[model samples]
Target: MKNIRDSHFKLHTTSPSYPILASTELGILHAKDHGEWHSINAFNLSQKLRDFIKNNTEIFEIDDVFFKSGLYFSDPNKVWIKCNLLTGKELREILCDKYGIYLSRYTKKHILINFHFGVTEECLDTLISALSQIEKNTLSRNFSLNENELSEYFVIPYPPGVPFIFPGQKISKNDINNIKKHQDEKNILIYIKEVI
Candidate 1:
């Protein structure tokens, strides 16, 4: 069932692959190899919408996403919902007019995984000037993670949908290579804690 407690996706058509997400109308095209499914939202709440949520009891969720569930993004205004059945207008009418909800259309976000640059004075100054991120010069404090390891339901935020570190899991390694290997990529940065 959808997080709304009484709503879900129903496929009106079939696909050569994942048959559950094949809908020409919704642009729910396909799935990734790791069972990470993605789709282009056909309906935006900013625009008028149609009643796409059927009056049935069939509940089908595509793993880590739901039609009307809230996701983390540091702000409520950045909350997004992916479509399975309900249209933007239908969602607004049902959830907003009736139940008082404020769900925005899918806001494409660039989520980084297992990486965070320290918020230092220099970093702030660079941000004020809008310069590129500061470099990591300290080698003794670097950390790394196993790209192919994670818990079944580890601490993860949506958008990038990557797993955050959790206790009791061997998802991390003592080597800093995994993180440094991707540092040159867009917005990928890691901070090494300092010792007193």
Candidate 2:
């Protein structure tokens, strides 16, 4: 075990794995016993949410956006919704502030919703109601990016920290469109040419 630990630390430059605590191990065992029920419930809720979003594509501007899931099977714990209308941060803020439904922001374009074991149908109804209310709200306009002028700046999106268009990299029309589509107020685009 010592040799294995030494080898792991040497290879990764990090501490070796630690054993699970007694309470955590027992919790894992308990979760294993009830995992299937939780999974099924989560799956059902996710399906319902998906259906709601699909039916309201006009309101949500979700025609281009899609859920990260297979045709028939999907992981029940979390659902990744790619939203074209709103940034993950914007969606997170709206859901949390107005409806009290907090969500994880996976990226500028993607929002992650988790359905846990204790989540109920009433919770789902609340979320649906919140979404309906949001439809009546107006979305803020975004600044347009000119394709020719893009060469003057490096454009990057945070919360999935990566550059959409970087300095010295050739920017195409499609790239500009995609960047404009995904760019949100929460994640500010840094203009690095002046800084450089």
Candidate 3:
């Protein structure tokens, strides 16, 4: 049962080794916006992305990146590294305007997780305990999840395209039977990769 749920949590048509990601391998993909941090270097963009990921662990990947030119340089420095990370649909729309990118496919509407990145057994156990207690109302809206909410759901937190919680992967049988128990009330908007 856990295995089945795990499978449901993953991206469709993927396997243990070959996971999907939001970013594509478009070498030298030019930034639609640019600043002092980086000019026209893919390596620099990738590194900046890595740094962003290090800070924001919940983001899955940048759907696309563009360079922004002619922005004020701050005291430290000014660089426009525009990329998409999985996030609330509303935020994505707002960011699209800030970055000058139209709201299109880059919007994020689901919570994504990766299998790698040190999600230990103990961490998973703690998460499960927390998730079971979240009320449907609390899960609604954009709010920081409490220990209970964060712990209840275990996200892989990398390789943004692939899924950590998928169908077929075993999960707590109680959770499986009582899908409504968890607070992800907007489950219809959420996408998990798996084969039923």
> Against the hidden reference, what TM-scores do the models get?
0.17, 0.48, 0.23
Model 3 per-residue lDDT at 115: 20
lDDT of 1 by residue, 2-58 (tens): 532322334333433343332532342323332131112211211111111122111
| Candidate 2 Cα outliers beyond 4 Å, as residue runs | 1-26, 61-76, 139-196
Give lDDT for model 1.
Answer: 0.29
Flag clash pairs in model 1: none
Best by lDDT: 2
Put down candidate 2 lDDT per residue, 100-188, tens digits, no spaces: 99875557766777788778889989988887776545332344456665465556554464666766666688877677666544544
lDDT agreement with native, every candidate: 0.29, 0.64, 0.34
User: Which candidate, 2 or 3, has the higher TM-score?
Assistant: 2
When summed lDDT is taken over every stretch of 10 residues in candidate 2, the lowest stretch is: 57-66
Ranking by TM-score: 2, 3, 1
